[model samples]
Target chain A: MTIEGQGAVPGLTARIFAGHAGPIAVVVLAIVVIWYAGAVYMNAPRQMDVFKRANADWGAVDLIEGTWAQDRPILPAPHQILAELKKTIIDQKVTSKRSLVFHTWVTLSSTLLGFATGAVLGIVLAVGIVHVGTLEKSLMPWIISSQTIPILAIAPMVVVVLGAIGLKGLVPKALISTYLCFFPVTIGMVKGLRSPDPLQMDLMSTYSASPWQTFWKLRWPASLPFLFTSLKVAVAISLVGAIVGELPTGAQGGLGARLLAGSYYGQTIQIWSALFTAAALAAAMVVLVGVVERVVVRAMGGRP
Target chain B: MTPSPVQSGPAGSDGDSVVRAHGLTLSFQTADGPVHALSDIDLEIGRGEFVSLIGPSGCGKTTLLRAIADLEQPTGGNLSVNGVPAHEARLARGYGYVFQAPALYPWRTIERNVTLPLEIMGMAAGARREKARDYLELVNLSGFEKKFPWQLSGGMQQRASIARALCFDPDLLLMDEPFGALDEIVRDHLNEQLLQLWAKTQKTVVFVTHSIPEAVFLSTKIVVMSPRPGRIIDVIEADFPRERSLDIRETPEFLEVAHRVREGLRAGHSYDD
Candidate 1:
């Protein structure tokens, strides 16, 4: 019947390559150019001195106006930040205890531990709630209400209460991260588990498949995309929790401590730098989730 | 007919009588009330026989097929396939069933969808792949193995679903208006292919359809049913040659069989109303 002639043309490969390559290449080139420009401006010795002097003057007006002062101010310019980043990253071993790396490590550890704990608890809760109608109806409202109480207002009380019980350091910070991270995972997972259609469920039933088999095969695979999406949100919130935990307790190291120290002495540059580092770390964590998503979905025979 | 076992070939042979359901009565607890979906539905389909059940929309044709497939339990009556209870028959005999719509799993590729039953049966990987390819070829969907259900047309998806049903080489095939959703052209094409497949495999088929012409064109026996407590009104036997083609639809015997089916349908509808 010559029906084979009706098949689709094999041009999808070239089309996909052309569609993705151009935009990706342009974005990468733009980032590189911007980084090079910033590096050149920040590393120039004369520009660095002039910017340091202006920052020291605290003529915050001139600071915003991009003018230079004679003497070094407390806050450094973009040039100064670039020089500091280069010195810390390239020349000096800033990753050690004497540098910012020790603080970053402290913050990262708490965030990771809290994120893991929160994610596990949240998934277990979501599974329970989804399976049990009474728990879903009763607990969902309270979980939502818990989010309304601002973490900032509660952080001090948590620190004091835990301190009275002699629990300090990582525990309090991990608790805060867990509190912030769990809600999204629970909500996302509930929706995901319920995402499978009735017909699909019936198909499983028609096969005489047990409840566990149906869950593992259909519901779990369907929930994956949602799980990863919520994981990204949960990870970011965990980092926020760690930083917030540090704020009330006044931790000796970590980015939160750096932020508090910067605010105390009005070292706005140090605060900004720490804030940037936290943001970068959060972005990296989310990207890690995306990579895992690709691998897992592919393993499940799904296209990205 | 006192529900005799209609044997066409040797006992336990491929073309021997496979299913016999007598005095099947089905009632459903509908929102309106307890509705009798089917009653006094005595039928026997021989192995490799292509039989169609035709009636009005609410005439319980699908219900009858579902009863045979063990998907629906009859309120009062007996349904036995291969001398076993319908459920046991289904579990042991493993009949393939196709619904009104192509209930293809959206997440699976076409090949994967066809492989689903095999996966459930725990067939070895190499054997499953070979069977999947063979069934896909039978349904004329050889190259579309990797395509998702959403990527295919309605006709193609339905064909893929048919492939899925046929993959395990089931003894009896239960179809509930499987081609009722397709357009006339696609329907004609699928009907021809189905005839060829039936001829090749000699599988027992119990097809439910509303179209009188389709029932006449495809079946060796057409069981005309009445609605509102559906009962078998009449059974019209097709006297055409087994090697019938699409062009046979234009022939005199074909027209005669279709006319008798229509008359039976009209009689049933008038009696019901």
Candidate 2:
């Protein structure tokens, strides 16, 4: 019995090239090259403007070197961001308000709170939607449309309304994060809960299992893979929400405040560092979710 | 529409009948129109009897099995299992059903999948594990209890599904093409094992299949069904010895029953729908 087109198990180099480091390295190199070019291009005009004002004889090389070395480049080079990160993150005391670590912690606390809330709410709503048809029809559409209104537009309102209610700081920001991240969890959970095919459903019915038993034994476990995949998406967006929530408050804490503070003071390096910190925070959160997903899905008897 | 008159099954005490469906009918309201899945599916499966429903695609053999298992409700006629309503029988844990596909929860170990019904029925954890192990061993899948379904071959997974169905020890076992997806060699091996399991346990099995040799070789009575209105065409009782093997399929007696089943199938079909 000959089965054609069955590819052999890839050797080490082929496996790496096909799925691991090879494509990643290429894409990262391309992005870095583009970043360097963009940094030089944007910063050159400022550098040239300074040279022109001083009436200095500056060539293209001088302008390039000047732009690259600037303490306040409009768009920081990747290396400049890296250097700024090391200076703020490693050199400064973690307790210092100037430290990126201090700012990141403020934002992350709210992000985690929001993410946990969203996860719980999503699962509950999903269960309801799966079991109760009315919720699926009524709440699902509203949940979907809730995301269409820009978080940036709603952030200030939420913060102000909560402030009016005498609630401040973390709760409002966490609410924003919850607002942003809950949709995917809700949608993904609904999809996951309904993931079982008809035969599984029939099997459950044949067992004379109750709806609750059917859910735990069949539906819930079946939905796990879907839940984890959505959690990855939700966790990253939750970071975005927490940062956005921080923006309207102008609170002297959080990476978003740091970015705003840099913008007001013309400290582009500070702004770039804050941006980089937020990016790193999002990555770390997503990676954490990925690790948890691998553990949970594998423990649930699936190939992770 | 000339389905054979209701033929009585082999004589048995009233208490011996695990499933008794009289004039069972089921229909679905589709976008196109009404589709009849089963009509007047009269069947009485006695205690320890192995009955196979054999027919072509869309012939309602699976439908009849599902109806007996209480997975489908008859829109037009009466259906009973264990001399009670199908749904009531289901609530009483009257039968365990095996589908065409393995349908094992991929997220559960083979043992856990087997223990799910037991768990649902509120059996103690220790008892569930013990029963799961015993059934897994019965299916010749003892060592693989800790493994996931995808880690096993198609045949082994189906066997594990069988073990899962049998673990709860329902009086009746409704199997819908349990080995339909396996290769011929694997199907033959499973058929032999299934017969042995049936003999040892003496559980009444209502099997659905499309294979003539499978029906002839394994069934105490073969119910031939057809598609137009989805009703039974003929019910042929076999007198094959209780102690049987895959080699029995090669004998003249098996061929004679297979020929009658084939003829019944032809008689039930019309050139036009």
Best candidate according to TM-score: 2
C-alpha RMSD by candidate, in order: 8.6, 5.7
**Is model 1 an incorrect, acceptable, medium or high docking prediction?**
incorrect
TM-score of 1: 0.75
Model 2 C-alpha lDDT per residue in residues A124-187, reported as the tens digit of each score: 9999998998988999889988998988999999999999999998999999999988889988
Per-residue lDDT for A1-304 in model 1, tens only?
6767355654665565677776787797797667545544443454445668766663545434342221233435555555555554456576664356677788999999999999998898888898889999999999999899999999889888999999988988989999999999999999999988765665665566667877777887788888998999999999999999999878897889988987987765667678877888999999998899888776655654
Q: What is the interface RMSD of each candidate, in Å?
A: 3.1, 0.9
Candidate 2 lDDT tens digits, B1-273: 122345556433344677777777899889999999987777777877888899899988887887778777789777778889988998888888899999988888999999988988899999999999899999999899789988999999999989989998887899999888899999999999999998899888889999999998999888888996898888888878779988887888788888899999899977575
Q: How far does residue B186 in candidate 1 sit from its true spot (Å)?
A: 3.0
Residue B232, model 2: lDDT of 85
Candidate 2 vs. truth: CA RMSD? 5.7
What TM-score, over all chains together, does every model reach? Answer: 0.75, 0.93
lDDT (10s digit) by residue, model 1, range B54-120: 9998889988887877778899988888778888877664688887788887677888899887888
State fnat for each of the candidate structures.
0.14, 0.79
Give the chain A TM-score for each candidate: 0.76, 0.90
Off by over 4 Å in 1: A1-92, A96-100, A129-149, A153-168, A295-304, B1-42, B72-82, B90-93, B106-109, B143-154, B225-233, B263-273
